[model samples]
Structure formats: C-alpha cells, structure tokens
Target chain A: AQSVTQLDSHVSVSEGTPVLLRCNYSSSYSPSLFWYVQHPNKGLQLLLKYTSAATLVKGINGFEAEFKKSETSFHLTKPSAHMSDAAEYFCVVSDLTGGANNLFFGTGTRLTVIP
Target chain B: GAGVSQSPSNKVTEKGKDVELRCDPISGHTALYWYRQRLGQGLEFLIYFQGNSAPDKSGLPSDRFSAERTGESVSTLTIQRTQQEDSAVYLCASRPGGGDNQPQHFGDGTRLSIL
Candidate 1:
C-alpha cells in the first residue's frame, strides 16, 4: 500500500520569488512519485514524476522536484515564480508492485502568486 | 481534437437522479482513467482500464458509481442515486500504449452539479 501527504493546503508567493511545495510519501515497495497541477475548472496536468531514475526531476513550466529517500520527501521547487504559475498542486505516490497503477493523491496545495 | 475529450461539459441534476458522463480518449491510446475532483481538493482516482484487463475499481468512492469501456474507445461513468457529494468535476485521461513512461493526456472535464 502507498499514501501521499502534502504539507500545506495553501502557499502564497510573490511573482519572481522562489516557490516550494512539500510532500511526504510511504510505500511498502519501490514507489513512483508525481506532481500535477490544475487550473480553475480544468483537468489536471502532469508536472513531473520520479520513478527511481533520478533524484532531480524537471518538469514543464519551470517546475522541478527532488526525491530524497532518507527523508521520504519529494518537494517541488521553482527558482522563480510566474503569475501563470498560480494554480493547485498535488503530490502523488504509487506502489510499483501494486496490482493497479492508480496513483494516490494528496489533498493538494493551492498556489497563489501575488504580482 | 488532439487531446482527450469529454461530453456534456456541464451538468446539473437533482439529488437521487441518475447521471451519465462520457469520455472519449485519444485515438490509439490503450489505457484510460477516470478521476474526481471536489471543490478545493485534489484529484481522486476512480477507475482505470487497460486493454482487455479487468478494470481497477478500488478507488471508486462507492458502489453507486460504475463505468464501462467499449472496444478501447469511449467510456461512460454512471452515478445512480446521485448525492450532493457526488457533485464535482469528473476528469478523464488516456495514455498511449501502457505503463507509466508516457504521461497521460487529460480532457477538460465534466462539471457535475447536484441541486
């Protein structure tokens, strides 16, 4: 079994400033981690994924996340935030050995960018 | 369209009524998924279908919800005795071939409102 936890429900940032969204995960076996973003009234868009390939995974929209096994964390970061980056972010985890490839999603963290 | 498409973009139904939402996955994609997003929440996995394999419905919230896929093409989700809690955006996604390497493409989603 696997589960995901997003540390925050809301994160406010200023345009051009750095952004961070924290996540923690637990899995009985090797796990796959992912981040997705959703705009108002829209479907989710994949941001990045970590499947034991690389610790640092870069995604579209200048977003990146690092997987740290020791800390059981995969935190998303952006060096600079853009107004368009304002959206809801989710941290997801899945068990590679699980019967289905369905992902377990966190409650989500809403990103509000103040220009 | 080059992406997944969902029909009846918006629907409003009275409580206890039945509603059917449709999903048209990308042409040639073999894996299709359905998810639910409540207001201010993250995406919740509902079900997934891969080829002719039996679908994974563990994530479905209740027995009131059911889905079907015909010949690797269209899918319809039926919610019987709909409750106010069932009101949310239902999203559909599809991926080419199988496995997790190729990211899933998503439809805009169907906004279901129970009044």
Candidate 2:
C-alpha cells in the first residue's frame, strides 16, 4: 500500500515571503514521489519528483522540496511566493515494486499568496 | 503534439446521463492514467494503463466508471449514470513506458458538471 498526507489544508504567505507546504508518505516499498501544482481552470503541472536520486529536488518557479527519509516527509518550499504561485499543491507517491503505475495523491494544500 | 491533449474541455450533463472523456497521450508513450479532482479537494487516482496489458482499475470509485485504451495511444473514460458527486475535473496523464522514474505528462482535463 502507498499513501501520502498533506499536513496543511491551506497555506498563506505574502508576496516575496517564503512559503512551505508539508507532506508525508507511507509505502511498503521503495517509493517514487512527486509534487504537482494546479492553477484555477488549468491542468495539473509537474513541479518535481524524487526517485531515490538527490534528496533535495529543485522545481520550476523557484520551488524546491527536500526528501527526508528518516522523517518520511517531502515538503515543498520557496524563497519567495508569487501571485502566480497561489494554487493547489499535491504530494504524490508511487510504489516502485512491480512497476505499478498507480500514484497516490495527498489531499492537497491550497496556497494563497497575498500581494 | 507537444503535450497531452484532452477533448471537450468542459461538459455539462444531467443526472443519470453518461459522459465520455477523451485523452491523447504523447506519441509513443505507453503508460496512461486517469484521475479525478473534486471541488476544493485533492486528486484521486482512478485507473492506469501500461502498454497492451490489462489496466489497473483499483482506484476507480465505483462500477459506473470505466476506461479503455487502444494500444499505446488514445484513451477514454466513461461514466455511467452520472451523479452530482461525479461533478469534477477528470485528468488524463501519460508517461513514457512503464519505467518507475518516468514523469507523467498531464492534460488540462475535462471539467464535468452534473445537474
């Protein structure tokens, strides 16, 4: 079984301020993790992914996430929040065992960037 | 051509009506996935297809939801007896092959409204 949990349902930050969205996961096998963003009326976009590569992964629009194996967390962060960064963020996990294509998604965190 | 494409960007249907959503994956990609996102919620995995093998439908909420894929190309999701709770954005994504690390490309999705 594989699952992910987004600790916060919502996160608010001022433009130019730092932001952080927390996530955790549970998988029986070596897991592949991903972060995705979706703006209103748009499709989901891949932000970044972790597949046992580098623990620290950088993503588009100046976003980044760190995979903490000990903590079972892959939290997204940014140095500055832009108005465009205000969107829904999901943390997903996929178990690599047997090459399954299923991706378990977190409930998501709605980021609100105030200008 | 450059990315995944979905048809009928939006659909409005009455209760008990059936709806079909189409998706064209990136050329040569052999892995396709379907997910649903309800208003103000995170994405829910529905199904996945890898090559010509049997699809994994474990995530589908109910029997009313069904999907089909032809070879490694186009795919369709059909919802029968649509209910108000079925109103959501249906997302289609495709990944190159079944590699555990391959990233999935997503389409803008079809927004379905049930009345």
Candidate 3:
C-alpha cells in the first residue's frame, strides 16, 4: 500500500517570506511524487513532480521541492511567498500495487498568505 | 477544449436521488481519472480509465459509485441513491497514456450537494 502524510493542516506566511510545506510517504515501490495546488473555486494545478531523475525539482511560480529518499520526505518550498500563493496544497504518490496506477494523496495543507 | 472539462458545476438534490456527472478529457489523452473531495479533505480516487483496458475501479467507495468512459473521450460518473456523505466536489482528471510519470490535468469539478 502507498500513502502520503502532510505534516501541516494549515500554514500561514507573510508576503516576501519563505514558505515550507512538509510531506512524508510510504510506498512499496519507487514512487512518483507530485505537488498540486487548488485555489478557492478552482481546479487543481500541478506545481511540481519528482520521477527519480532529480532530487531537487523546481516548479512553476517560484516553488520547488526536494525528494529525500533517506528521510522519506518531499517538502515543498518557496523562497518568497506571494499573496497569490494562498491555496490548498496536496502531496500525492502513485500506487501500482494492485496493477492499477492510481494516486494516493495526503490530507492537504491550507496555506494562508498575509499581506 | 485544451483542458479537461466537467459539467454541471453545481448540483443540489434530495437524498435517494441518482446523479450523473460528466467529464470530457483533452484531445489525444487516453487516461482519465475521477476523484472526490470532501469539504476540507484531500482528493479520494474514485476510478480510472486507460484506453480500452478494464478500468481500475478499486477506488470506488461502494457499489453505488459507478463510472464509464467511451474510447478515450468522454466519461461519466453515476452515484446511485445519493446520501449526505456523498456531498462533495467530484473532480475529473486526464493525462496522456503510456506512462505513469505524466501529471494529470484536472477539471474545475462539480459540486454535488445532497439534501
């Protein structure tokens, strides 16, 4: 079985400050990880993905995440938070155990940016 | 359309009624997925369709939850005897087939409310 756990349910950061959202996963196979953002009344948008090529993955809107196999962590980070970054973030892992390539998602982290 | 599209952006129905949600995937995409999102929870995988192969229905919560996809184009999810717990945002996603690394493109989703 594959599962993901988001460490924070809610995170608040001020504009121009750094942002970090932590996630951990348990997968039987080499995992493909992804980070997606969903704004209010909007569909989910992909932020970044890690598919074993690189440990550090850069995504759109100045966001990035590092896949740390040793720590079983894939933490999303942004050097400077923007007001537009306020949204719900989810960590996902691909599951191939039952011969079905489905996704297992975390509970999600709600980001609140303060002006 | 250039992206995945879902119909009936919002639907409110009485308990015990059956509701159907539709999805139109991007052209040339062969893989489609359905997910459910409760008020503040993460996305729950409902079903998946990849080309003409048997769909991975492992994620469907119960027998009442059913879905169908025609070829590689449109898909429909039907919920029978809708209950209050079934009230959630039904999201649809699609991606090009042949690989598991591709990020799934999402739709705006349909908000279903059961009264």
Q: What is the per-residue lDDT of model 2 for residues B1-115, given as tens digits with 9 covering 90 to 100?
A: 5899998899999999999999999999999999998888777889999998999998899999999998899999999999999999999999987776777899999999999
User: What lDDT does the true structure give each of the candidates?
Assistant: 0.89, 0.90, 0.92
Which has the higher TM-score value, candidate number 1 or candidate number 2? 2
Chain A TM value for model 3: 0.96
- Candidate 1 differs from the real structure by a C-alpha RMSD in angstroms, to one decimal, of 1.8
Residue pairs clashing, model 3: none
What TM-score would every model get versus the actual structure?
Answer: 0.92, 0.94, 0.95
**Backbone Cα, N, C clashes tallied per candidate:** 0, 0, 0
lDDT of 1 by residue, A1-115 (tens): 6788899999999999999999999878778788989899888789999988989999998999999999999999999999999999988776656566656779999999998
For model 2, the superposed segments whose C-alpha errors exceed 4 Å read none
Top-down TM-score ranking:
3, 2, 1
Evaluated at residue B42, the lDDT of candidate 2 is 76
- DockQ (model 2, Cα): 0.69
- Across residues A1-115, which tens digit of lDDT does each residue of candidate 2 receive? 6778899999999999999999999988878889999889888899999999899999898999999988999999999889999999988887766446556789989999999
Off by over 4 Å in 3: none
Against the true structure, candidate 1 reaches a TM-score of 0.92
lDDT tens readout by residue for model 1, B1-115: 6789998999999999999999999999998999998887777889999989899998899999999999799999999999999999999999885554466788999999999
The CAPRI class of candidate 1 is: medium
